[model samples]
Target: MGRLCKLHIQNDFKEFYTPQVTEGGVVCITRCDARHKTPLRCVYGSCSMTRAGPECECSDRAAFWYQDQVCRSRISKVGVAVGVPVAILVLVTIVFAIVLLRSQRQKEEYRNNLRSRSELYDSDDGNWDAPQGFAVGNPAATWEDMETPSTSYINLERVDTSRNIHIRRPTVVR
Candidate 1:
């Protein structure tokens, strides 16, 4: 009975001894090999012993890498590669759209300003007519009255034809 009691006490202490103690106190209770087994399987990773006892070393696959402690959450490198350019393209498109809308608005404003100015200047009610005196051919005139004289003589007596003028002729190069 005494030996059985000692064994039970030792077995009870064994449970406490299995846990590792660090500066932050007790950490993992199970060994790395046991933690890697059936019930406590580390998905997408393998268990390894560290200073904190057992830890999961998550595998980095071709297109994705594990991000969380459990190795269940993944961050895709391929997704980032594709998503970044698409985001930039969307941003550029939005900027171009905004610029185009602003340009159109400015042009419309300019046209409206021009229309308002023109309307201000010409405020008449559209019934304006030229005076009868200013009308074409109101005063009957012969076709010969509109004809210009073919010969016009200049007063050459007042002209200064005696002024000396120099003309340079290019010499031919042999």
Candidate 2:
């Protein structure tokens, strides 16, 4: 069998490709009857010099760069004047997505911290108090673990009987 990559041409495997360079808008073709084993010197419609025998040296102008067969190169929406801004916009969107992903990671970390704290409280002993730190007030004072009465739930009847009602609204100080 022939090599897996080698082609078995039925009719010379003739294919056509546009030449690279041209005067203005001319379409060029290589010689159809080139006898060279290498297709390198087989540019179409080239008016320049020919290579020696077995060299098959085609012109560089009609290579990949000039394969469109036109003097001017091809330009798409990506390279067009209006396309630059669109590319910049897409890049900005990607940056925003990255930033948002980073923020979500931070949020996930905070959520994990909260979950751990809750777990600590739900343990067997059931006492997971907040640690001592520089909170909003009284940073230097220590906490007293002595049992205290429910001062926050004072009886309203006792206060009503003990105190007199004030008639006027409190005055604001500037």
Q: Estimate each model's TM-score.
A: 0.43, 0.29
Write candidate 1's Cα lDDT for 140-173 as tens digits.
2224445433433333454457677699999999
| Candidate 2 per-residue C-alpha lDDT over 43-92 given as tens digits, one digit per residue, 9 for 90 to 100 | 43333223322222324432333334322343443345567888899999
Clashes of each: 0, 9
Q: How well does candidate 1 match the true structure in TM-score terms?
A: 0.43
Give the runs in model 2 whose Cα sits over 4 Å from its true position.
1-70, 74-79, 121-174
Name the weakest run of 10 consecutive residues (lDDT summed) in model 2.
133-142
Residue 64, candidate 2: C-alpha displacement in angstroms: 20
Task: Please estimate how well model 1 matches the true structure, expressed as its whole-model Cα lDDT.
Answer: 0.57
Top-lDDT candidate index: 1
Q: Distance from true position, residue 162, model 1, in Å?
A: 64
